[model samples]
Target: MIRPGLTFKLSILLACIGVLASGATGYYTYRANRTMLVNEAGQSLLTSTELLGQRFSAAIDDVGADALVLASLPSTANVVQTDNGLGANAPREQLAQVYASFMVHHPEDLQIRLITRKHYGLELIRFDRDADGLMRVEGNSLQEKGQFAYVFDTLAFSPGRIYTSPITVNHEYGTHAAEGKPTLRLGTPIADASGTVVGVVIIDIDLAGLLNRLQSDLPSDYRFYLANEWGDFLVHPDASKTFGFDKGRRVLMQDSFSATKPLFDQATSEVLLNGLVQPGQAAGQVLAFVRRPFGSSEGSRFIVLGLARPLQDVLSGATQLGNRIIRMVLIFSVLALFLAILFARALTKPLHILAYAATHLFAEHAMETLPLKRTDEIGILARCFDRLRREIKSQMDVLHNKQRELVHLATHDGLTGLPNRMLFMQKIEAAIAEATRREEGLAVLFVDLDRFKQINDQFGHSIGDKVLAAVAHRLTQVLCSADVAARLGGDEFIVLIEGPRSAEAAPGIASRIIGALNEELLIDGHSMTVGASIGISQFPDDGATAEELLLNADAAMYAAKSDGRCAYLRYRDVIEARKLKREQASEGATEGREAEPTA
Candidate 1:
């Protein structure tokens, strides 16, 4: 056997340690750098998306304000007064000059027309750009705009309020807008001095231009996406996919990004997503943020704005950073191992202490004394071990935090932040066992928001969401801390009331919830009132199981809605009476038919 020198043995040992330490440090640093990069990108994109939504809204509002201002101008009233321009002189020069100057300042205004309700809808004074983009008054080219939805829709709106038409191609015959460029019509009901609806002042907005204006100041690498209320990609980077509805293709943002499906539903206003962005690409992924700009606002159908960047582009620096760190680590490892061999004799005493400490490696500050006593390569090794332990603990803590977040998101409703159907059912199962063991009564109230659909249809989904949120808040306020309130998706919510005395307690609680929600909700400057119909089912009385209770409560709620909404009803009492009445009515109708004629 060859008796090797102490320095030679130490050199071999430190060399082995350096290799392992380099690999461990390199991998940990790489992972940490990548995570940090992704996190920074997420935060940056989220903030940018929020800013973009605000900027988009401000852009639309500016155009709407301008249209209102032009509508209020004296020249607009003059043009409307001269309906059927075949009559006395209409002073067309002043109106032309007004539109010309306004169009000059707001070059995106494609066409500004004062269309009077003459011959159904007559363009009394039309201001449009020529083929060369020069402002011109086409009074001689007057045409009928009665068939346009924008004209008819505006006539119905309150005066001074702008009603924006759906974003679509300019198919109208006499528009200055290019044949296939995306366009939106902003119409303001022009009422003269006497509050009489005279005509509609319409402005054809170049949607493409508006979007470009919104994107002008953004990063060059960032891509913009615009979708309508139905998720149709109105503006896409791929021009072929833009206005896919007009081509009968039905291309949707959700088809590519399922995470943004709820953007229009108002359930998810803003969300960060990561995935294959090119419609059909495997392996590669990009990070994107989708946000709805028109949050609880009137005018203009909902338009969702999304901004996305390639993930690799975001993490470009991480690779370089990792490489540099690995190289530095390798150089340091080589140098430290060389020095470790020179100090091989000094390592003996500390090594003895370390061997003793290593026995209790998992103990708190196990090497505390070693670090304080030694000032050699061994001390450096001890400090590195301590740092590694802390790093491992930190990573473990991060993993645990992520797990907790995942569990929370899994159990809670995205909207209203209430317990979802699954979680609620689980709670009900537990509550049932508890109630059974204690011989106590448990009541489940099924609540369906009444007139919610009407609000969504009449106003918009944004306003509807506000009303739902407000109603949820009010319902929460009326419930005791022990009571459990959960959203069963859509307009349905379930509440589990404990320790109910008699059947009246459930009904009383339902009544208070109904009354609280029925109070006026001021959403986006609109005073809206929504109500709920609640159905009560008690444990061991109406139903013994969660499913049975939920079903019976739902049936009673329907009865409440049928009888007259904004009311609460008990399961058996309300349903049986209605069934008996229906049976009696059926019997009477049968008797009448028998007594009448045999056809």
Candidate 2:
């Protein structure tokens, strides 16, 4: 037999082994898949960045050339000439037409603006076309053109330079908007034949439009943003319209551009001219970045274009794969548990069968030896059980006989073989319930042999017991089929008579009991005569509960002794009244004794 403790330990060890094996396999599979996914995503991001950079550079070059052409037209001498030459009465109307025409021609360029340097201000010219297909320019004054004083001052100092440069400038055109819209202004210096800088030609493209184009080419889950040297957002695809120059208005560079910022800043510092750098310092940080120095070739303004991809994304993919693997493992675990339980049951089947057979062997008292057919461990157990069965059977026979003797002793008197007090009480309680249900009367008779103590004192207790047994036999013989008789120890006995109609009927059963006791009893080779006084009480009318009825019957038995020695009496209200009077008399006597206790 396997010990219960050992079986439990083995089952737990097996389950743990299964879980550990599944978990380890799941983790490794998840990690491998995740690494591959992140690599793919990084490669795709780098490819898209290259494509977007080419498109953005091309658009910037086109806008720069267009701004230079419009700035040299001599029509921009004043707001009125700029407006009339562009064929619009208002500067804003002329500029709006110029911009509208530009948007129509270059539909991919979402916004186009021409900025001029005059009186330390930027005049915003937009291209518009009339019904005649004639191109017009509208000049709009920038309110915060003072903020861009550095741009004009730098261009004025070196007018010989006329290559593309990236400048971080603040907008002043729209007063209804916020104070400053920071932008990456791509410009080239416009100079005279003598190589003296007259003014800078600026193309004020929408920074957000450029970023939107860049981000749209990337994956849906990834974030893309562009920030200038000051760590301010030139363009943020998520919250684009709110980009500006106030400290509070600056975009959170640490949030959207966090993963790529260090690499971008490093690239900005390294390449004073156009060049490429690795994504990070480590071998794992090998993302490609291209830096194009912005502003004129000989100018103060320089801007770097940064592109990066992190291996952390690969790690994230691996984590997701690990979760999936865990789910699969959990599914397999449930299957394993079910199969393990089935296998365990199969292994324990013989034991279960043996247990059932053992239970039946004891219950049915089978005398045959255990049937051990095989030579396995189970057969050895069966052989052991068979030996155990024979030993138990031998003891069982002795126990059965002893038990029978005890049952007889419990329910019958040792001397009389009549029902004892315990059995009598059980029968009486049952009779009371039956009588109440039938609305009939049950009579409880408390019978005491009269002058029985005289017999015991004159003769020995052996003779006394003989007399008592003879009386018990006589009572049982006289009892009706619906009646019970029991000895209450010594010379006292009780009888329960059910199906009686009234208390009046109780006297007849009691009288029969007394008359039977009056007959001569042969005990110890002598004929002796004894009388019995039986007191009877009826159910429901005499007492509601069992204890009360038995108590009343006992009191009536004493009353029978007081009335005379050898008759029976039925319990009545007078008996209870007499008991009450005796109690009162006893109380009065107690009080009088207390008062007179001085001596």
Candidate 3:
């Protein structure tokens, strides 16, 4: 309220008028500067996150390349073949020294193991750093590790590709980490000449060392964190939060930085959260995260790498500028604030829009083009956000496509492009349900090449693979559209003939498959003639379920091989009669084989 003094009211009016203009100008400038500074801070955070990911990616890639080369050595393959040979001692020693040399050269590596699958996975050669940091090769100390997911899981993948393990406390006794040093493993499969998985080469990485490398050469203020796919912190500034599972309690990154919880839910590979991150964290923690996906056909999903720092450090300069602007504004008359608050809303409008858009982008995985018309720094920030949204979407699409491909590759056979046993079993189970519901007859045909081993011996497995592919194509052509054909591995194949055909027609279908394979195949300029012996088993007649049907069909197929080289056999209820017939047929087959000349 103005004083009754006419001159005082007039003077206050003049002051208000002048301050309103100045306040409006100062407020706009303050907001524009603040937004720009925050934008720059965000950009710096993103850059640091990206640099961390790239550096770590490059380092792991180099390690993986080295692992591949080491796994490819001839002695590595021989180790699997000569596991039981008396002469293996020398070769094993050489491998141990070779791995020891690797650990010596790379002290950050906790252990290097060339392990083969034998009962529980067998360690053919293992070299690990002791608690004293000395690289030691254990020869007679080979232990069974088949139970570890790292050992068996890596065996499922093809050679040359690297598989990474989740970071955890090292549990194996008598090594560098026996005291529970944090560990991670990089594993690559060892393949024989025919591309068969013979063993796996695993390099144990020191997680503490990895964190040091990730933080190397960076500013003293910079901090790095690592987490597994589930967002459980694996590496943290406070070591106690890391691998909390080992302590029987789970402490998650999402729990600390609740803002990033949506990232994992959205399956995004990268994200950045600004503001207070966790309880007890500095009031202005800015955390940026990037996911490092690693696994075989199965997913342990990703290892999240993050770089975090105090936002106060980044905004210190901006804060100083803001204080100067505040001091300038305080010189204004009190009435000016009434108008400034009303006008400040319009200036901060863009900030709210940008914040809303960023939140929506991650939470909903949907986007609307931001208001990009302004020629100010806010507009530039909006443009960057919009671009990031587009890029994240593009990356997610690619990630989804790759995930689908991995799923397909996991279930399908690599050589013949047919469904492998895993997929085949699923289809058979489904087909059995359908048959049971409709009371329709179903057939399971087990087809085995009569002399596939002979073919492999005569003309390397390369030709054998080609022959198998050709046979797969022929089987697809002979079977009905409703039928499912799968390679049960090696030279054996199984087909689930669903509806569109009766059990009586199974023998005919099997015969047709046999006839199709009987034709000469020109594989790699070698005219090859191979015969198939297929056995037919009907659902509810020979067996009730998928496993039972497949088992019966397999037994019947051997009977077909015994009856004649190229023929089909049907499962019957009388096991003894079928056994007698197979025995007599085997005798005849022996006599026939005796008549052939070896040359």
Best candidate according to TM-score: 3
Q: Please provide, for model 1 over 154-236, each residue's C-alpha lDDT reduced to its tens digit, 9 standing for 90 to 100.
A: 88877878787778887667565546778877878888888887888888877788778778888878777888888889877
lDDT of 1: 0.77
Off by over 4 Å in 2: 1-349, 358-371, 389-434, 500-505, 573-599
Could you arrange the candidates by lDDT from highest to lowest?
Answer: 3, 1, 2
* Model 3 clashing residue pairs (backbone): 121-146
TM-score for each prediction?
0.48, 0.39, 0.49
Root-mean-square deviation of each candidate, in angstroms?
A: 29.6, 20.7, 30.1
lDDT per residue for candidate 2 within 1-599, as digits (tens), equals: 54344356478768767666866687567655754665565566556555665666655656656655644544333341232223335654554555566556653332344444554445455332223442433333332242464456436645433344343444344422112434444455545555555445454555554556556656554544455545555544455523455544666453433444554465433211011122333233324333333343443433334444445643654565466777877777786778778766855766766777677877543324343765566667878887787788889989999999999898988888778878877777887788778888877889999978988888889899888878877887887766777887888888877775446566777778788888887777877788988788878777867687778888888888888988877788546768899999999999989989775
Q: What local lDDT does model 2 show for residue 478?
A: 84
The number of the candidate with the highest lDDT is 3
User: Candidate 2, after superposition: displacement of residue 270 in Å?
Assistant: 37
Q: What CA RMSD would candidate 3 show?
A: 30.1
User: Pairing residues by index, what is the TM-score of model 1?
Assistant: 0.48
- Show where candidate 1 strays beyond 4 Å: 1-29, 87-90, 135-140, 275-286, 293-300, 324-599
The local distance difference test score of model 3 is 0.78
Clash counts for the predictions, in order: 0, 19, 1
- Which lDDT value does model 3 have at 349? 76
* lDDT at residue 589 of model 2 (Cα atoms): 97
